[model samples]
Target: MRSYLTRLLIVIQFVIIIFGLLQNENRAFLKQLFLRSDAVLFNGSLYRLYLHQQKPRDSMLVASHAVDDYSWLGAEPFLVIAHGLGPKLYGGDNTIKTLVKGRERGFRVYEVDISLTADNVLVCYHGGDETEINAMRYADYLAVCRSKGQDPCRFDDIVSYARKNPAVSFVLDVKNRFYDAYGMIRNAVGDQNLGKSFIPQVYDFEQLPFIRKDGLFAGEIFTSYRSALTNRQIFDYSKKYDVKVITLTLQRFVEQKGDFPRDLVILTHPVNDPFIAADVKKLGARGIYTSYITHRSIPELFTSALFFTPLKQV
Candidate 1:
């Protein structure tokens, strides 16, 4: 691994020099570049590993088998997040228009953040760092989003649309720890007969025990991985519960890891760069979880499963 470290450092140094030369004024662009640099560094090192593969086709990223593709069902493609109408970073946050755009892009599964207003209403809103959305009720929350021109809507607002489009699915990333919040969301989804259409993306592993008590199936819901769990523990949890799990992994864990289970999907926040998608695959993940919508997220899978070709591939 000594040579690997050397190569990584060299790539990082090269990236810094290139950034200095560009001298762009946009802070968002610069921030995105810096975030993507890790993937570039990791992918650069991966080329070396590929040069010395131990088996025939061991280096190829293209997975022919459905199970190896990070999909529980073989028939559908697993690349899920497409925020807003377009894949551009400077787009609206989870708008109805964006959901329509994701469908236009051939994505069946769309991830949306759900925050509970203090009055127990679930709304589609992005949870800001350190911001507790549940502290406010529907009126305050709606005003806040409207003030920012975010075009936010209630969870039921989106689910009603899902009910209309039978093929579409929504993965709800709940932002509230309130018991009533869960109950309200469950009621809204069930009342619309869209329970199967919506999937809960829960954060706390400690809440797993309460999942069933709260009316949920382990295999149906996904866990948003935290630093509290190691890669091995994450793998074990998914295996035991038969649930899909999402892990936040930077380059530090990518190249060094030797194996990964098929259900463990690796997620990177605001993944503007597409190379990170390829690198995630290199880490043996099922797919990637990203907020920014882009077909280039995983060009290989994007092209292979274009239009989610078959309804049931398994």
Candidate 2:
């Protein structure tokens, strides 16, 4: 009787496992697991069935090394923008030290948060209350940075740095009062380099017309994290404004992957994991805004097999 009961329990557990495997909530976990290039004993009919369910007639997934794994990313080369000057190496985000470190590591593009002071000075800062920071005078802001042992960077300093490194580009994250920030930058860098070097990130479609009317900016990237527009509206406005790249949160990307136009370059933010980055890239992300990943680390990231070779259906 004991032996019979044990066998029945084993059968029940097997059934439960099988049932869990087929559930929708578990599909994502299973997808990540089976897609791993290093997954052992995962090459049988079960793998084939999962692939078939995800897409009816896609190519068979082949396991390959990191070098070949990202080959699908295309010849354009994946661009990485240093988030807040690439992760507080010298101090916190938007500091001159971090910016210099990012540039040394071969990052030509950087995202800097620009806050306008009460004295109407443009500075690289993102902290505390936006209104309170905006209300403080430039001198007072500098004093505050000194008190906190943080290095403060002004727009003038950024312009000077850009003048020295002409190839560098800045993606301005001006939370509110974008027009004021734009005019200040234009005044500093001149109208010629306003759009070329200092790219303004518009929060919504309404802000586009104001920036677009003057033709002051050469390019504009739609940062959709804060946007309320539907995917269709986002795509439509992108075309109308000639926006070449659109940025959204990773969660947003996962939810609206099918709605986004594949032809456009879609960028996602704050991806630190090489595995997650690989996953998103395979899903059609062209670039990422990261704090840890850089041009210098790509080869090392691959050699270590952090980006595992999945059972890819070609």
Candidate 3:
């Protein structure tokens, strides 16, 4: 009878453990579903998905590295303006106009390409021929520009622009997917010997080491994911690379529920509510990314202030 009772107790414990595991798995799956749904909702329409699908794909390791260094150096908060469909949709003049206005308004600007390709050429436009951009080299793209009037501006041109405007920094968002293309961009950017006069901001975190090696721009990387595993993987990568600044979508930050490791700068879209912004700051976020600064303009509403006020003596 004693042996039988002991065996039964063991079986009950095992079942309880299994049930807990199943519950955890279910919660994780639900969280993932929610994240995907939220991403679609945030875009506001299925048309946005199609628009994103049509963009170029290229690895942006160099840009990622640049962002990392910039954050490490403690730069001011800035805005990232995305230009879609290349220079044809929004010409260089329009693009420059927007960037100039952002600067005049006391904001820094970073431009990202929408296309992804193997050559990993990150230029000033948003979307391009994904198939053609990925299949051909940057040089080939230049040739097409000369022949077909497709390419808008060169990376070097942006560098020169940054040199001319000392107060502004260029954020290059590489939309590429291939990893090797990152190295190609680094090579094109040349050795880090370029003085601080021409450093541009890069937004990819994976390219931190390359940019550090290249010695051109000083910026930090921004990465986002919909799943916990991917987020953890990125966090691990950041640790290994010693990255200091990280960017996440507002949804991801909320879903994590204050579980994110602290002490690093967290950048996210601006929130208008003073309470919510205070909550987010309480959760350890360091900066807010916004289309306009007005969203977070409340004075004396920081997280630290709310939590650390001295108590009156009784």
Per lDDT, the best of the predicted structures is 2
| Span of ten consecutive residues with least summed lDDT in model 1 | 305-314
Reference-based lDDT, each prediction: 0.53, 0.67, 0.47
Check candidate 1 and list the clashing pairs: 70-286, 74-313, 74-314, 75-312, 75-313, 75-314, 84-98, 85-98, 118-136, 118-137
What TM-score fits each model?
0.62, 0.69, 0.53
Q: Which ten residues in a row have the lowest lDDT in candidate 3?
A: 79-88
Ranking by TM-score: 2, 1, 3
Please write out the lDDT profile of model 3 over residues 17-75, one tens digit for every residue.
Answer: 44654687655554445435434433313323533432112343432343334532334
Residue 237 of model 2, lDDT score: 60
lDDT by residue (219-257, candidate 1, tens digit) is: 344442332333454456555554555544443245325
Could you tell me the lDDT of residue 256 within candidate 2? 59
lDDT tens readout by residue for model 2, 101-163? 887777778888888888798988876676777677888878888997888898888888877
